[model samples]
Target chain A: MRLLSQARVAGSVLLLLLFSAFTLPLRASASGQVTPQTVAETTQCGHVSLQAMIDEAEAGDTLVVPAGTWQAPIRIDKPLTLEGQAWPVIRGDGSGNVVAITAPNVTLRGFVVAGSGKSLDREDSGIRVSAPNAVIENNRIEDALFGIYLERAADSVVRGNTILGMALPISRRGDGLKIFYSPNTLVEGNVMRDTRDAILWYSPYSVVRHNDFADGRYGLHLMQSDHHLIEENVFRNNSVGVYVMYGTSFELRRNLIAANRGPSGYGVGLKEASDVLMEGNRIVGNRAGVYSDSSPLRPNTTVTYRNNLFAYNEIGLEMLPNTQNNRFQENILLDNGEQVNVYGGGDLTRNEWAFDGRGNYWSDYAGFDANGDAIGDLPYISKSLFDSLIGVQPELRLFQLSPASDALDLAAKAFPLFAPQPRMSDPAPLTQPPALPPTPGLESPPTATNIVVAVAMVGVALTILAAGLRRSKRQRRAISAQPA
Target chain B: MNGKIIWTLAQKELRDALHNRWFLLYTIAFIGLSLALSYMSLAGAGIAGFAGFGRTAASLINLVLLIIPLMALTVGAQSLAHEQEQGTLAYLLAQPVTRVEVFIGKYLGLALSLLASLGLGFGIAGVVLALANGAGSPMAYISLVGQTFLLSLTMLSVGFLVSALTKRAGVAIGIGLFLWLTFVFLGDLGLMGTAITMRLPVEQLLWLSLLNPLQVFKMAAILDINATLDLLGPAGIYAMQEYGAQLRGVFLMLTALWILAPALAAYMRFRLRGDF
Candidate 1:
């Protein structure tokens, strides 16, 4: 396999070679194995000569489809590459799957794979991969049990694809792209619409990035999965943007979520989820944003919410009663009905005011910036002010709803909005924003704080290692009946 | 005089137990297995819900599986038959020790030591899990230990009863394990199979399933003791409630039998025998 892959790499384009060259061992050079392994053994599939195409295919052959309409399911049993020539169309005969890749290393690309949804037992769908390492990229998928279903497949990559799901589920069972018991998968640069879930991870170590997910029951969901990285995905008009339950370890960063609503679900729901680090995501305009409330499994869940923007949601934040050991820090909360609707539980600390009157902006703040430096002199204690006014006198809620009101005017001028916890601020707020590269992607720029967070993790890891070694020495002494 | 003789007999039984090599080896094996299950739970298994799952009053559900038989076979099966076969019973009986004294002494030594060993193993496993796991309340730990002790005592009584009834040690072991294995796996399985096989009314099946000892234990384990469920159907929310209550009663009755039946059998057999 090493010799074969090396031979293939030698035949690959310069950029492909560059990516592989650094990581791959030099034992299998292009000089000996590249052309024969990759180029010579390619499977060219077509309706006219199916048997001939199958014959041309070796164990690890590449099946290349030219740009033409083929009315059949492209079935591959062995290890083979099924590459398309500039978006070739694979139209099904109102039957089962458009393509079924059974063996490993089968790559499908640049095709309009459509027309599934036949029998209830046998779902009509775009692609069904039963094995690992099957790359389905740059393809147009429609009307299926799943756009790309990796049933129990592992280590696959689904990227740069435009996938549209069949409307409502049969018995509430439909997914745009789903993977099960799979790890190290990369789902990136995809446009998904009208799907139950844009991406779903089962067992974990999957990476989802830079995808546009809209009009789905849930944009992204994690269940019984671990160590997944969900980065820079845009979730729009979904019932629930992200629903994580069971056991999940996700690194959620730099995602834009907006205008999602649910009767019972959340914009970002964490139920029974554990070990999550969510940072730098823009969350807005949901029935409720960031619901980290209680579930039966809440006792085991711990998540860190940091450096994100939470604005224009019905409820800014919710901490349900059963939740524990969760920390919030350095985030902005602006323009919401209730800024912090803590459900009589959970812990919060280390958050900064986006614009304290001392430099924070609460949209509803009555304090003034006398120095004209875009900051008020006093702090904002959102919890206390709300409690004193609306909580004590429920009727004052309607009275203060007006932007410009009567007796409320005197209250604002007299007192400072006392923030519950002390704010952790940037000593040097940007006078003028620093110039950054004009990159066109959802991915965030690697900031100094992000780097420090990463470095601090390494430092902690080293400390743990040292402690572990010492503990081992002590255990050895105890076991040998000697004092350390 | 009778009391002194009984004391001497009890001492002799304890000495015999110490020398029983197979008994010692099997005890080690059981310890190893329980330890392994504890290890698996702390690390994380998909089925940790069922794996090494012990609660305050219910882990006795697993008792019907192996522990009961283990206790029964080690002491109950071989107690009389082995002594008779080795011709030691004749020699002991020739002395002033009455049959009642001999029976009490033998039963106490076997029951106490076996129960103690089982308790120690359970304690060790609980400690290992507590040390390794990231979190678990002390209440949960105490609950587990308490339940384990209760189950061990119940099994010990059952073993004693089995020992009394038969001259053939193997038969006694078989009978002891038979009750245990039936309750552990067979009873629940039979009930489930009956429900599935006979297109019986769901409600009827629900009522009948209460008889299965395994189901009772499972109910106790799954639903702790704060409250009880009362079912009215074969399946669904209401049925789950009913099954809970029914299983609790069943486990309690079965455990009582473990105590009453074995001791009664030994007493009757000892009284009827003429060898002494």
Candidate 2:
């Protein structure tokens, strides 16, 4: 009976080996090699057309395209994920979008999408999303008119994608990520370059963070949108860092806007935009740091600026005369050609320069403290005769600090009637520039001078204190007749 | 004004101020703070050596705007107030010196002292900054120093006027501190508060700024710093257009008027005084 049972086991083992050999090839064809058995609804496409496999896939299935270039526009109509096992390149022959997403809950990840149609009017994109809640992540798109175009695709996520556009002129090129009428989208961790605009058009309640936008016309161009959160993005070498128009209640924080030197060349431009909470953003090396044209809607409404660093710009903050009720506090205005430039004459005095005994650090503030208080004993006033000339002519800025200008300033000083009215004033101006957190992508190497100066300052204070104590003791004892 | 009598009284005033340790303190404070500020500005950038001309000039501007005015105001107020309190004015008046001569003489002495202190303080700071940062723009820095002196003159005039108004040295000192606080600190707060509470016109704000000599100095000196033009904003732009080539000249003249008007008022008060 033992011998018979052993023979049966050997036969069963042989049968199992034969069964595995016969079904493995079929399983490989049915499912992707990377995830053969783990994913129950995975369909692998190799040597066969991706469209054919996609057609065969059931709803809610995943189609894995492995390691080959496919030359056709793909359309997804069912709820599924088109995952690239080896970053499959989907090429288009200049007709329609390379990948058309029409179904809800569709995910297109790990793709190398390239060569969309060349017509600007056609709005051809590498991936066009028409359905809501679509996710386009970890895709590398190149040479496309529009990298990712979403129309009415609300609540979608487009993350971890690097989109490279062709070197077309600003007018000829399309946006890297174009979202139209799409609300509540989250765009994160994408590095987009050489596009007309990294983000274009309107998306209400969208969160765009951690994306690096470089060499574009506009890093983020939002129009007629409301309540958007844009933070921690690096916008460098763009024409305009961020062109926000008519956007209300937007929270723009901690963004690095640098080296945007295009025609408009603004780190952040606001036109008729209201209720903007711009905090902790570094507006560095731009032509104009923050340009606002009628940004405030109501007479009493205000856009707030707190703890922002405006450094190495031609003009730090330029606002229109109509832009009123704005507040600036705790911001470091450093090394800008102009700290605040208003056109056509406006009352910036209505705007609060300091709140709660704290104000911005103007690198040009000529104030000092004598009584050991860190606050400057005098207020820092900003006013320039040259500024007024430039405002009216917009041409005399060529001779900004020329000797002629200096002579003119000297003459103004000698003549009391020539003194121009001050534009703004900050009471309690800090003696030291606020110690700011390092900005990402714009951090400078550390230096040791601050420590040395701080130590020296402390030593001086100690000496002064000791001297004062000794003097007081002598005077008191002499007066009381208690000295030996 | 008798130049000989004024000159003689002015010499006496200068010798007294120098001997009293006030001049030393002022000059030392200016030097220490200016150097500290220059170093501080460079320290933040983590850059040693030269931070360029614009940056140092900018820092110096801050120093001048705050310290120069306060120093001038206190010294000017104290000089006259102390003389009146000690009965020296009566003695001097009895001895061939007219009240106008005493007033002009004291003003001249105080102005020279302020100028010397400003020059010495800034000169030392400038040399130190140049040594540390290589060389920036000497002309601009010098121009800034000069403008600060001009600001000092205006504050001195304000001081003299205050001294002439008050009878006691203590009162003069109190008023001096109060004026410094008001013009340099509280004035801005009040203006900004009024602007918020009452949406004052840009023109009105500019006019109101003229009430403070420090503001007058700032408006004039801001043109010297390239970076400050942008901060001048639209109103400044408007002024630039209106003032044109005369902008600086007008500002200087205005600041001078700030000096001359108050000094004249103090002289008139002294000339009319029956207490002497």
Candidate 3:
């Protein structure tokens, strides 16, 4: 009986220790909220500077900045949590970073950071983090050279941040979120606009998702990055949507890159990038849907375009003619002026237009399918002697679809010598356009004018036929009345 | 081969055409349609005036394709068939002119009337378009006019062949309309339908285009514009490269042959039959 009582006492002690381990932090945080300081001594109240409070507090302390504008650059050199009660504004002196996190394991949340220097060389930012494992979330940053500059800040998380830049030109303004050598970073739910770019410079394995980047020079500029996942982002009204230069093994999925009209306007440009898988992305209303140059570093690289909807672009898929092993499958190329225009004078036969049994759905395909097969009976061949001649002489594009061009095509057919090679062919063409998600506010159907014209033509033809029949019948009667 | 006799017969035929008011009717139609289409092209897309002239040529091509063939065939067929039915051909053959001379004279006179009609119709449009587009590729516009002329000649020859084969004026006119419909509309549809059903090689489709004179005209006009060549697909590019400079010449020769062979056959049938 004595030994059993001793055992019960030991079990109770163990349970008590576990309860204290879990509840102690919760109780301390609760108390800390009431008085705003429990772990370390901080400024009580009154009008004390934020720097004074930081200097007085311990390294691991929590400082709650009051609901007022903190002046100039606030340097955080300790592992601390600077939480704001009512979104305290940290107004910079227009010289350097407004809030620079130089120490690791720091969290800066619920603050409005603004006003950095205009010098691009110094790399001024609203919130600049040089330390690893820092979290900068729920912050409203504006009027900054760079919104959030993370230099060597590996494994950091910058989420739910709204980054807005000044009204300067793209060349003068810094990026919305510039990550240099920051690997394994998660940049999510950031709304950025009017910035130079959302850049990833040598930032490998970064996951940039659900961000809205608009009205910038480049929506997302990736330079020498590898193995990045950019998904569900909307890049609208930028100069270039996603400029992937020297990027490799990137997964660009379900993103909408649209209306990016500029000098070298491209929805997505892949320059020497290899092993890029672009799928389910709608690249619309740009000069070039996807401008692909040769992957010179990696020869015989296969860049794929799968399930993409390329629409209303000036030139869709403007790639170098010698870009070998590039495959396009199940893409809806709808209403592009030139569906596929080659940059140089070389054969594009090496690029595969269809993979497996399915090819792209061209909006202009006129072939019909009998026997209820959804695939076109013949291969969809996209070529034009006019397109070829316009490639050489651009002004001839003004005479596009002219009868003279049609005559030249007839001439090409009559004489085998003038026949140009097909630009591209889809072996298994789809009868209907694939059901892509409707873009909001841009659901433009095919022109009603063309349909009206066709109907008018049929009506005219029927009328002409009826008139001719009557006249011929009258002529028959007249002939019968006359001597045979 | 007597130049004086051929000239006299041609003059008589031209006078007969003028008296029948066929030339005036065709001239009015060509001018009216061409002007209306040109104005519509200019007014379209909100780009009024000179900017639209470049676009006008493209819009008028279909009109030319539809109207010229019907006019050419009906006139050519009715002219010869009506003469034969009236026994005027027999009277003319009884004169010093040979049957070959009669055929050539009639064809040349018909050709002159067609040229006059087409020239009046397109010449006004060309001048207006050139002024509007500010001297837009006049060469291209001229080429379209030239193709229309060739197409008309070819259709006229086809009408001659139909008229020569039959005796009744009504039968000749009916056959001429059928030929017009077949060549202008049905020939392409049939070839395309066959191609789709049978999965014919594009090369075969390319060569088959030569068989129809109107198709030859269509292809020639389309290929003259650089962008339309891509619509021809890859085979067109292959054809362009293979033939290079010879492509245009080859099509022109093919069109010329379409004119000559039918007329020659009609002349031979006329001479051998001696029915007139």
Best by lDDT: 2
Runs in model 3 with CA error above 4 Å?
A: A1-46, A295-301, A393-417, A437-484, B1-276
CA deviation > 4 Å runs, candidate 2:
A1-47, A443-484, B1-41, B47-276
The Cα local distance difference test for each model comes to: 0.57, 0.73, 0.72
lDDT of 3 by residue, B57-165 (tens): 5456667877888888987787677898999988888888788789888887777667666766676655544434422354565577778889999988988888888
Q: State the displacement of the C-alpha of residue B199, model 3, in Å, after optimal TM-score superposition.
A: 43
Better of 2 and 3 by lDDT: 2
TM-score of chain B of each: 0.72, 0.90, 0.91
Residue range A1-484, candidate 3, lDDT tens digits:
7556545654454354345422121111111222222222222332445665566555655555545666758888888777764677888878888988999888888889999998899999999999988899899999999999999999999999999998897789998889999999999988898989899998899998988889898899999999899998888888899989996788888888887766567899888888888888888767678888874337655788888888656677777775767888888886666788776544567777788877888766878788556778788887766567656544343333334456666777788787878877788888765555433223322223323333343354344333323334455688789986
Listed in order, the DockQ scores are 0.00, 0.03, 0.03
CAPRI class of candidate 3: incorrect
- Candidate 1, position A430, lDDT: 25
For each candidate, give its TM-score against the true structure.
0.45, 0.57, 0.55
Which candidate has the highest TM-score of all? 2
